[model samples]
Target: MLKAQETVLEIDLKALKHNFDHLKSRISSNTKFMAVVKAFAYGSDACEIANYLQKLPVDYFAVAFVHEGIQLREAGITKPILVLHPQAVNFNILIENCLEPSIYNVKILNEFIATASAEKLNDYPIHIKFNTGLNRLGFSENDVDTIISTVNESTSVKIESVFSHLAASEDLNEKDFTLNQIKKFKNITENMTKQMGYKPLLHMCNTSGILNYPEAHFDMVRSGIGLYGFGNSEKENKNFKPIGTLKTIISQIHAIEKGESVGYNRAYKTDTFLRTATLPIGHADGIGRQYGKGKGYVIINNQKAYILGNVCMDMIMVDVTNIDCKEGDEVIVFGPETTAENLAKTANTISYELITAISQRVKRLFIGN
Candidate 1:
């Protein structure tokens, strides 16, 4: 068995379950809940997280790529899985794995239809993504006719759902814009369903959308950050327990004289004699270089230690002055005491980037609930 003491990412399944239940409570009984476990479950551990959620009877599981869905299937997940942004090249493999793909445009719709027909697949479920407002991925309103024609001409594929992405559901300032997107998506869904004579599950809400706009909770809500415990806003996060706790042991300590410098290019200079501790985590481990130079911090023995100097690929130095610490002391990089949200704000990024940027090299130890 792998020891928890040997890792940085300590995944709390108890917390994961807590967050899921919290979000579940907010959802309507008619609304299906889909858990987004892509990017290794936001860089925690996708397989373990999915396996845990599968036991909780989530309505659906979504991944960004076909291979990620395959990973969940390989891990014995038998739930309905959606490939949120599958490429045309993987349509066959996606079909083989019984994974649903989100058809965004004419090219992908045509490709999927051809592949499903060639494979002799009948009524394989697929989702249509409309570009309500995000403009990142999804078919435009003008492309709907072409998409409907493709679907009507194919006997091998069926529309499983029609969805869109919300560009700013978290910002209350953008409420009007978000509502506009909701209206657009509703209008598009109505138009397409009228043309096709059937409506699949309609979803356009992410974690933030699900919490902020219940009226737009069409048929399902896809949760990514909410499942991990950090909502897009502080108000939304209050109801959920955070699922990931990033911690590492201090490998070494250093005593610096006044005016002494630390790390690359003397990025941090001690104003007075201070104690500094170095941990075996750096940018390569997803700590990121932007977290250094007094911009970010970590919690040591419940005390805040400002980061010093440029973050290296395998290590970062923290000014632990005035705190009683030693080599091998556990350091909380971003957890209960100091959140990844706080760290991200200091680094001019977001919690999503902080969590998702966590490299695969970091060791993950899952604690089952």
Candidate 2:
């Protein structure tokens, strides 16, 4: 393990490759893979992660905004990048950088078409996102005619792919709903292709979707959380390794006598003599206040030290009375043993929330080349 002066998020590139290979093995041989590197690759350094995957030679990359794609382009990532949520103001930048936009609504589609025409671009690749069941984004299935008409009117831009987000591909109870979504996507794509005279690549699966519904792999599949080493299920999680480990060190230890209080607002009061260790991380570092007051914990010397008081913006106190630890000892906030999934569950959240919530201030160390 690398030494840490304070808090650090260690990213294992070897584990990342293992996850990519494992997820790739689950999909069809011809199906292409797109790595979702949005939100700084889920807060683990998007440039570095994407750069690493670029060598792995992923078929495509997806980001949530135009600035993210620009960052990757600046970093020399030449793969086709899909901007999932793009704004008109950044449409010109997207065009200059050759980043494709996922046109979910007519307004965006029209705006992008106008921009592409102004730029004198020919056959500019753009993706069409359908609403399917995730009513968050995408055109409604009922708007198929409008979509076809809009594309037919556009000569500068061409639909390169048609995709949708699965609402609940991970939940076994929602199997029927997932199947229905797949069916809807197929029908919408078929109708669009017939009208356009050429079929764009069709994809509708995310990480969980790929693992649970392989039959709907279509032309390509996207892997986000799964690429970061989570399966969204216990069975599949065993086959992958977590790529990130958040660790910190003990800054100081305090001996608290009975009736003594700890941390902001005196959230924890000692009933007996105790030893408390202060860690140099708290809500500001993405260890939110909700995990304070004895609800969350850290692993020290293979022992779980429960949080004893409220978490501050820069510090947290843990009950380390039983553990024989000293200042500078390594403390694991979440890692292989203390999985991010388990930690998020203790806070009544999910692994995605915890992993992505890691603050950018924390230094990230890449290991396992």
Candidate 3:
């Protein structure tokens, strides 16, 4: 085990593998799995996580943009990487690095085809993204015919897969909408494949979709949060183990008398004498200001330490009076006892936001490889 630092995110590779194997067991043996490693693997060392998953031999990898895929490539990730959102400006780089681009619209499709043709590339792999119900970054269902025609015109690029996003697969209340999305994606892919001579791979399920909509797990499935140990539901969360633990140390302790304030703007004032501990972490470290003033807390000595006042840029004061701890003592901002899901709930957010917000400046210590 690695020693705890002043502030570090302890990443457990064993937990990651467990989650991977668990999710993998849920899918069919023939179904391909693509691990989403975008946003630095949800802000937990993308290179390290991708390297580990590569050994698990996931069928593919995905990232939100071209630069992220490029970073993975630079780190020696040889697995086929699908850039979820690729711009025309980076077409050359994407081509040079052999990174597949998810062509979402007419402009991107046309531009990438033109660039690929100019580069004399042949049969280059490209994924097509349909909007379905997400209304995000994808071609609308009505554009399916146009998309097929455009792909047919491009001799340099070949469609590797057709996929879409689920807007609310995690919400049980949105089951109808999620099912409708799956149906729409199915119709789009079927129509495209019928028109084209060959059938490309079909995939639409994300992490939540994989858990809730097994019937829609087409030719492949993509997992992001699930790989990092979250299932978007209480029951499913219990089955997976969170792999990242945000930990820090108490920098100092202060004894404040009655009516004294703590931290900036006097957001927290003491009614009586109380002890507070200053931690070397704050909004700049990804614990946003909204989490301060009792909204968020930390775990010390197996007790909760509420934020005393407004979180500062690089420091935060926590009410540690009741807890027995000293300077340099270990503090779990969020880990096994206080999960990221719970911390995000306290801040009125989700685990995705909290985990992804962890800053690059904070060190990441890998354990249990």
Worst 10 residues of 1 by lDDT: 1-10
Q: Using TM-score, rank the candidates from best to worst.
A: 2, 3, 1
- Residues 1-369, candidate 1, lDDT per residue (tens digit)? 122244478788888888888888888888899999999999888999998899997999999999999999999999999998999888878888999999887888888888999998899899999998888999998888888888888899899999999999999999999999999988899999999898889999998898899998989999999899898777777787777788887888999999999998998887889889988889998988888888998888888888899999899999888889888888887774477888899989988899999888888877766
lDDT at 108, model 2: 89
Give each model's whole-structure lDDT. Answer: 0.88, 0.92, 0.92
Per-residue lDDT of candidate 2, residues 1-369 (tens digit): 686777999999999999999999998889999999999899899999999999987999999999999999999999999999999999998999999999999898888889998988888999999998889999998888998888788789889999999999999899999999999998998899999899899988999999999889999999899999999999989988889999999999999999999988888888999999999998999999889888889999999999978899999999999999999999999987779998888889999988888999999999987
- Scored against the true structure, residue 4 in model 3 reaches a CA lDDT of 65
lDDT of 3: 0.92
Error of 3 at 83 (Å): 0.5
lDDT of 3 by residue, 1-369 (tens): 454658999999999999999999889999999999999999898999999999998999999999999999999999999999888999999988989999988998899999999998889999999998888899888998888888788789899999999999999899999999988888888889999879999998999898999999989999999999899999899889899999999999999999999988888888999999999998899999989989899999899999988999999999988899999999998886589999999989999999999999999999998
lDDT-sorted candidate list, best first: 2, 3, 1
| Root-mean-square deviation of Cα positions for candidate 1 versus the true structure, in angstroms | 1.9
Query: What's the lDDT for residue 178 in model 1?
Result: 98
